[model samples]
Target: MSYQTTETIQRLWDDFLRESLAEVPPEQRQQFAQQFEDRFSELLQNAANGGGDGFLDLVGFGDKGPVEFENLPYPYVQPDFDDSVVPSQLHAAAELYYIYQHERMKIFKVVDVLLKLFRLGKMRIQRGPGARALYLVEKWKPLRYGVRDRMIAYRRAFNYGSSKAPAGAVTNVNFHRQLVGLIVAVAQYFRDLQVSEVIRGGPMINQRPFGSSATVQRLGIDLRYALDRSTYGNIFALTMEVGHYLNSILKLLDAPDIKKAFDANTKWNVIEVVSNRYLGGTAEPSQRAKMAESGRRILKFVADNNFETSIDPHLFQTELRPIGPHAEAWLAAYRTTPEGQRFPGVPTALRSTRNRKSIPV
Candidate 1:
């Protein structure tokens, strides 16, 4: 299969920007174009060098480079759906529930990084958009119910007695959409910081004059160097996987049987009902609101920093320290987990049956 290259993706982005900015005045449009171009070009270069933007580059959708996607293992498939054995609505809910778990894990991973950064006092944002954003991130902690408790709720729901499940065991109707939105919001926030680093010219370095013969030279600091590259790379790959799982849930939800399971007019309604009943726990309106507000503030900061004025790179710098062992363990577990490894159906032993069927010449 033909793979997409940085050049191709760049052209597509350019065309998209032109159409998107058509309504803006010429001067503003030009500025917008330039900003996007610079950020996108840097992203492309990074992805080509095997450092992806956490989503686009890891899944064979990035620029062609030394890392080849052609040899990647065959994609994992979910279990085959059987409406008779399991209600379509229940199946869809279960899938969404699984994906939600993964999403939560990804969020926790990012929060873990940020928390470490906070504890080390390495990030230097005294006040401004970065400061406010960092404050919100530090304060943001989603409640995590015990796995056993959640599993019990799942069992009750599958048994068609979801109403009897414990409080806070079921998800709201808007769970998938809301969860994905939050994940993307957080992802973009970090992405903005990543982009800023690239924009400021990677790894601050001090240079000496060619003829200076100085015995010792001052070295420039790279904020990112404090964290392990593998750690960040894992986070990016995991985020990309979350997106793939989300797409799968959408497909499952769109099935005709799943749609017909609910009395509501649309498939979305089906999702809402299934998720609320089968997935445990009432929605936290207050927490959601807080998260939304925080997201808005950070995103606004990103927009201003991207187009108006850049955030100071110094604010993110910290004394070099290794990430916490718990964070490392979490990432390690994520890499080794076999939760999503099941194939949808039986697999053939050989790549092609045609070879076996052919007569000897």
Candidate 2:
């Protein structure tokens, strides 16, 4: 679907104004139309000028509101992994790096989908709890972890003999928890949209009033096509795996031997120490960049070719050739360890596989 640009937005505003003013009495219509047009034109102009907060706020969809985090229960069960692999610090680092990259890349895509929905007028947010929840999602940005920052963390946590690791590479012990909270917030926003009656079952474009009868009739289509079942399923799968990987990583970091190896006092310290040790080298810079790029491509691939549909291997290989070498390298290193020899294959987080199961919205 074509995104709404400035020109299209102005056209949409003009159409909406013309339709709305048609109901006014002929004697007073000219004055009313003039006033309405002036106000709406200003709003459209602000939105076009990257001052969307003003326009969105006027339409009751602004980001300047209080948002309450939903204490929603996460229902996905953690996948089982062998305890024998817990002592493999390299394996733990691999999982940590993989999941962190996944989290970083996924947020941009989520924002993209959200922005598209809002721009197309597929999702309407009036002033309420729902608006606040959506505001939280819109304002959310991933933590600023650059290549050097991540590499330092990895080295500190994994390489015990690195003293020259960069300063300012701190770790958030609650990183996983925070990410899970964002997931909950997103789910809450979707629920709010449904409850507000902004989304309904019908033809993509229909005459039925959405949300409130008093609201303007938007020219946009239903949001279902943009955020379909496949999209939700993929999100579910990704989040569930993330949670699983995070739990495993947390356990590894918290292990007594791991803490003693690095003289770490807290989970954050363990991360800082291990990361500094393992990733404090010149070669890591290029590797880290490749991993990040590969991560983005993988996410895009999954989003485009969802689990419900069969993916073409040739196309997948062509698009994700860079990932194959990295995945193989990690696998090869992992196989050198005793746990890898016993339980062979790509780790859960690194697999280019998809599941057909759907999670409850």
Candidate 3:
């Protein structure tokens, strides 16, 4: 039998073998290598079947790269339904829903990016176009609290204090909230459409009122509707409108606030604060050393995963801080003049990078 593998997958396999040998005892190395290959091969098969580039995506390797402004690929830029062409209403609607579902993860990414920038004080909520940004922030507030509780639970599980929670502990929480928020938004939009069917004897044309999690689970059922062209167009338009609003809010962020927020005295970067708690605490010397090692590993994990990898502490300094320059550029571009308010082009696909720049704090 023949097998196929990409260069990246081959590289990953080689790296895995090398690392495993160093970690596993000589006597157990063979057994561990066999098990690792079996599981990795399975993931590789899944990736290959899904039109994936390679198994690199299964890890965080796909997103590891230079920091730049995060932009979502606009899915409605369909070749089949271009400006000259007119797709059937039902066809367009169904396609839009499918596209939204397929790109749902990117929507979550957008929310996560917004939240992180907001927390860093790089982005501020303006009055007009900032409404969507504010709405998302407000919706995420309770979710953030829930995440903090989960983190506290995690700390207790590890016999660690709340202050000593591992670096990047809240990452999973942010991911969960963003995913749920996206699902709820779509679900609510569909529910409003259904409600309009009875009262007005037609589909809802506007999406302003349906941005909540109340009907999220019903999204699966709502996907079955045979909507008209106008309805699909309306939904497509709404998606673009929301994207534009997000972009506008991001561009209008306050750079001064971001600089202030990131100041060393005020901002407690995960790497520095966590390391100090473990490496510089009153624990036994051996325990402190172990804790510091753990902290380093945690920072590497977060950086590889492309989440909260911005601040490079003295222990783990690198150029992965992508937010500062991007934020500065955005602030520079924001304009009060109508002609200067052009939105940047949305990415057509996920951006890739060959290297990452780490900023020293």
Candidate 4:
């Protein structure tokens, strides 16, 4: 996808990548080397699927030349929805984003905040206005945690230790809290030094008596290095890539030697729970009817024997195996649900054959 950042900012991003990679040091890279390769492969897949020529040129395996930032087909800009007036499942999503940008939480802390929102079942990322920016919590998985660390080794080198936190460790609660404090301190330090102004925005519209959207943030010593779009987007994509690589990561961690990425006290067992919050979908107060309808179409498509490649049980067992435990259950239940056949979008004729709902996530 074409980046929305300025050409100048994009050039700076390339330079930052070079510097960050240099700073990782050989010893550290050795630890996550296998993961880095797997993660890179995943990123390559996403870039191919979602990015345009610019991304292909800048990030491809061995393209070493002047950086090209313009002339790439841009990601279509969608207007920010008047989230204040709309019914949304994203109240928690907005809250988390507000907290990260204003509260300056580290990437992991932001993920935890998202988990809380997931339990509450709030909005998915609001495609504010014209899809100006998507803010889904889909990026808060263990893979995302790994991606964040790998990103440190390659993009935000200086930002680490001084800007964010130390490099070469797994994401955990303690580290998240520490990183949040560190980022805030860095912002304060720069503000006190008169290098830059702290940034701020929002009053969560659905504010309970105590909840509010008012928040602030500041990049540090250099205005260029602030945790703004450039830093956030790169890391965000890496997070998605990581989430997608969950299968590979879990496989790697299965070996006793690779499990060290988890800190000594870590307790998050990777459970396969179907969370609406995580998928940017919620069962309560969300457009579940819409999702259900969407889900049905998918079920039909998968069930269709005419497809170029039939989406069989084998496909589910293979491709979506990570989230399978839940996806399979949902599909079965929905196919049998009283309202399953009544969903809006399903074609009537095919409805009978697909009356049974079994979708693999």
> Order of candidates by lDDT, top first?
2, 1, 3, 4
For model 4, the stretches where C-alpha displacement exceeds 4 angstroms are 1-158, 161-226, 232-237, 251-361
Model 1 ranges with Cα > 4 A deviation:
1-231, 281-361
Evaluate model 2: give its TM-score: 0.20
Q: Write the per-residue lDDT of candidate 2 for residues 198-276, one digit (tens) a residue.
A: 5456553232222221110010011111222112212333334444644444453464544454577864455554345
Error of 4 at 355 (Å): 60
TM-score of each: 0.22, 0.20, 0.18, 0.17
lDDT score, candidate 2, position 211 = 26
| Candidate 3 deviant stretches above 4 angstroms | 1-84, 87-233, 252-255, 259-361
Error of 3 at 26 (Å): 82
- After superposition, the stretches of candidate 2 with alpha carbons farther than 4 Å from their true spots are 1-235, 281-361
Query: Please, what are the lDDT tens digits per residue for candidate 4 over residues 260-284?
Result: 3222221122111112324342222
Candidate 1 lDDT tens digits, 1-361 = 1134544665688688878789887546545766776687566555544532323434546454334554322222322221112222322333324433433333323334434554676444345443444455456532233334334443333222133445544323333233233333333334444555445642222111111111100110110111111112122233244435345444434545434434545545544454455444223222333333333332222212211112122222211111112222222222232321121221233223213376679
**Full-model lDDT for every candidate:** 0.35, 0.38, 0.34, 0.33
Candidate 3 on 59-137: residue-level lDDT in tens? 3355643222222111121222112223343333323332232122132234455455555655544344433444555
Residue pair clashes in candidate 1? 168-281, 169-280, 169-281, 170-279, 170-280, 170-281, 173-272
Find the candidate with the highest lDDT and give its number: 2
C-alpha lDDT of candidate 4 relative to the true structure: 0.33
